[model samples]
Target: MSNIIEKNVDLLKKANVYFDGRVTSRNYTDKDGVVKSLGVMLPGEYTFNTKAPESMEILGGKVEVLILSGLDNNWETYGAGETFEVPGNSSFEIKVLELADYCCTYLS
Candidate 1:
């Protein structure tokens, strides 16, 4: 069996609060067997467009965003701390209004 490890932001030596900055993360896998990450924009707006794998799912988040998925015609606005699940073989584009933070997690 594979050993499970849990990392807390409070206990991490590299974790620090950002007041007004933007941070982009590379792709990473989470403990829940999900590919999870975030693109943080402090006090400024940002946009992201990507093609997620078929099995990808948007678990939850807290930020205002416009979601344009291949499966949907109109854009979906996700409120603060919202959750979404993605279908297989789909693509999406996201746009954020104002300064916002978002969390993305994918399952394999």
Candidate 2:
């Protein structure tokens, strides 16, 4: 996928701050009306609950993820250019090995 999204995007000016500012993201909607967020996470561990099915692309840095559902609950590592999916109405634990940049696309 391309790194740049050049047009027809509606971005919110305010950020969605979480974990006491350890994580921050800006919400945006694409031309196709897909809700997405571009965010950065500082080196730390965090748990996030999802309301919608999400596709998380790792833009930079390394992270270990453990999805908190289903029988196969193992920590998987992902780095830049990798992607993972989280089920709707579920949660996951993430350990950011370094400062990480990510983009989250909410699926319908």
Candidate 3:
């Protein structure tokens, strides 16, 4: 991923708050027409639903996750500079091991 992004962004206010406000995000579209979002997750367990295939890169801290149809009930850990993918029409449970900062790409 590039180290830079657009300066201006649209905030998703009044919605997209999850885990009782423990997670929050702001989304933006790039010049190439790809959609992405920056999000922060406080220390908590959270579940996220996806409308499209999503790729998330951890920018800070760490997370352990159990994806829908995850292998052998396995839970995977990811940290800064690591990435994970979730298929569209699925859900994943994430345990925030630390204050995690992430950027996600929404892929159609």
Candidate 4:
């Protein structure tokens, strides 16, 4: 879970706001053409549905995640420098324990 600094990327001006603005993110295309988003999550629970496989990196805070499609079905906690992956066409539940800074990379 190294810190990711994306340079030479194309970013969208509009934000992706969800859960009544408790979560917000900006989508961007990195130099390598990978799609990603940088977002902040206030302490709240959120359910996200994904179209592509996603790698979620915890940048600064803590979160508990339960993958809807995973076999384990147990909630897992992640802190700074940790990451979790979710498969495409699946959904996940995330609980933010504190203000969380995160990066989500969409995988092909």
Candidate 5:
């Protein structure tokens, strides 16, 4: 609770629960009912399986991602303040260039 504040209703710590301890996140819902997660990733390559459309924003550092349904040629690079979208029922691969910080929204 110390690291949380008002309306920051969800907090998910990296306690080896998901992604084999590779990722950690804090979930919250805004006033408009938009659900989002603020998360961090260590320097590494990661693949995420998606069941719903997702919008991702990079908060710090950079990453190269391969979204099978979107990008054509090769992995695309995204840096701080950059964003991208991935479709539902698909998968995306991400390579973190640094300690990547990000926010992700699941769209219905």
Candidate 6:
């Protein structure tokens, strides 16, 4: 069984912009774990790294992303408040062109 844990992030800063939201909760087990988080962003470009053993599922928002993992590098674009899944063991980054709000849950 996995245990649920709550995390909070009122805001995340990148390049003079702020991403605001609370990281609601997360669940973890011996073999796997899941983390849920949310963020709202004003128009800008930002970049971040993804640690291993983590996957991200976008619950909402619109943005463009570039993923570079294991020999596969590509650009992915999302629409308003869309859901998308990103596999673990991949390194990626994101860029936003407009005001956007998103929630993401990570599974491993």
By summed lDDT, the worst window of 10 consecutive residues in model 6 runs over: 21-30
Number of the predicted model whose TM-score against the real structure is largest: 2
List the candidate numbers ranked by lDDT, top first: 2, 4, 3, 5, 6, 1
Model 3 is weakest, by summed lDDT over 10 consecutive residues, at: 7-16
Candidate 6 lDDT over residue span 3-105, tens digit each: 2333343333332233342223323222334344545655566655555344443434567878766566678887664555655655556776665656555
Expressed as tens digits, the lDDT of each residue in 1-108 for candidate 2 is 446663889999999999999999999998889999999999999999999999999999999999999999999999999999999999999999989999999999
Off-target runs (Cα >4 Å) in candidate 3 are: 4-15, 70-73
TM-scores of the models, in the given order?
0.48, 0.96, 0.85, 0.94, 0.80, 0.54
Query: How many steric overlaps does candidate 2 have?
Result: 0
Model 1: what TM-score? Answer: 0.48
Better of 1 and 4 by lDDT: 4
Candidate 1 colliding pairs? 54-88, 54-89, 61-81, 62-81
Native-structure RMSD, model 3: 2.3
**In candidate 4, what residue range of length 10 has the lowest lDDT sum?**
1-10
- What residue pairs are clashing in model 3? none
Q: Is candidate 3 or candidate 4 better by TM-score?
A: 4
The alpha-carbon lDDT assigned to residue 69 of candidate 4 equals 94
Better of 3 and 5 by TM-score: 3
Task: Candidate 5: give the clashing pairs.
Answer: none
Ranking by TM-score: 2, 4, 3, 5, 6, 1
Per-residue lDDT, model 2, residue 77, is 99
Residue pairs with backbone overlap in model 2: none
Model 6 clashing residue pairs (backbone): 61-81
